[model samples]
Target: MPRLGLNPDHLALAGAELADESGFEAVTISRVARRVGVQPASLYSHVDGSADLRDRVAMLVLGEMADAATSAIAGRSGRDALGAFADSYRDYAHRHPGRYEASHRRTSPSPRTVDEGRRHSTLSAALLRGYAVPEPEHVHAIRLLGSTIHGFVTLEFTGGFAHSAPAAEVSWDRIVDALDHLLRTWPTSSTDV
Candidate 1:
């Protein structure tokens, strides 16, 4: 029987906290169960294994990020909207490095995972709408924005910019400005290849 108060969500939440505290790699079934003061076997009732636990953490992180982005971009548009969206991602990563790392974990697809994953894409598409990017080029724009934010956050979180001159914040602001400019002046293909 499942523990009286333990469920998948609870386990996942605890695992997420663990990830935030000790790094995503620390979020194992045994570790979570330990955090919950239960035997490792007790977690079987809530999660299939570590992978499932990690997936749940990923879903959780994605949902939190989507919420942050949504709230940040509300009542905003153009460069303002773009800056809010970009800052939302950077802020979330800074606030929750472990959860941010878990968000990048590989996972097998499921309905829940698929839906959660779409939230980011949907939010990004909405942000791009303000720039009036061509429908056919939306995919490229989304990829560009996603890669830029992800790349910056990953490098920043990993201390890639720690030893550099000029604080990371300066570069971040400049990059966001550049992105806004790029989106505003997105090039159109003159010839259909």
Candidate 2:
């Protein structure tokens, strides 16, 4: 029988906290069960396995990230919105390194996760709307923005910037400014001269 006062949500939450505290790779059914004061088998009642637990954590992190970005970008537009979105992403990654890493993991699609992903994509599309990026190039712009933010945050987290000359903050700002300019001046055609 399942433990009293234990449920999927509780297990998932515990798993997420474990991931945040000790990196996503450290999250496992045994660790989560231990955290929740239950036997490893007790966790099976709440989660399919470690993968399901991790997926739940990933969904949670993605939703949290979307919420942060939405709040940060509200009532803002253009470069202001861009900067706010990027800053929110970086801040979240720094504050929740393990959960942030979990957010990057690919998971099987479910209604909730699909909607969560849409919310993120919609937020990014809204940011691009301010720059008037064409429909045909939306995917390209989204990929570019995602790559830039992910690259920067991953590097910053891994001490890649520890040996750098100038401060990373200065470089982040410059990158945002450059991205904004690129979006604003994106070519309408690919025809060569």
Residues forming the 10-long window of minimal summed lDDT in candidate 1: 184-193
Off by over 4 Å in 2: 190-193
- lDDT digits (tens) for residues 75-105 of candidate 2: 9999999999999999999888898999999
User: For model 1, how does the per-residue alpha-carbon lDDT over 6-103 read when each residue is reduced to its tens digit?
Assistant: 99989989998998899999999999999999999999988899999999999989999999999999999999999999999989998898999998
Give the local distance difference test score of model 1.
0.92
- Per-candidate Cα lDDT values, in order, are 0.92, 0.91
Give the C-alpha miss distance for residue 50 in model 2, angstroms.
Answer: 0.4
The C-alpha RMSD in Å for every predicted model, in order, reads 1.3, 2.2
Q: After TM-score superposition, what is the CA distance of residue 161 in candidate 1 from its true location, in Å?
A: 1.1
Leading candidate by lDDT:
1
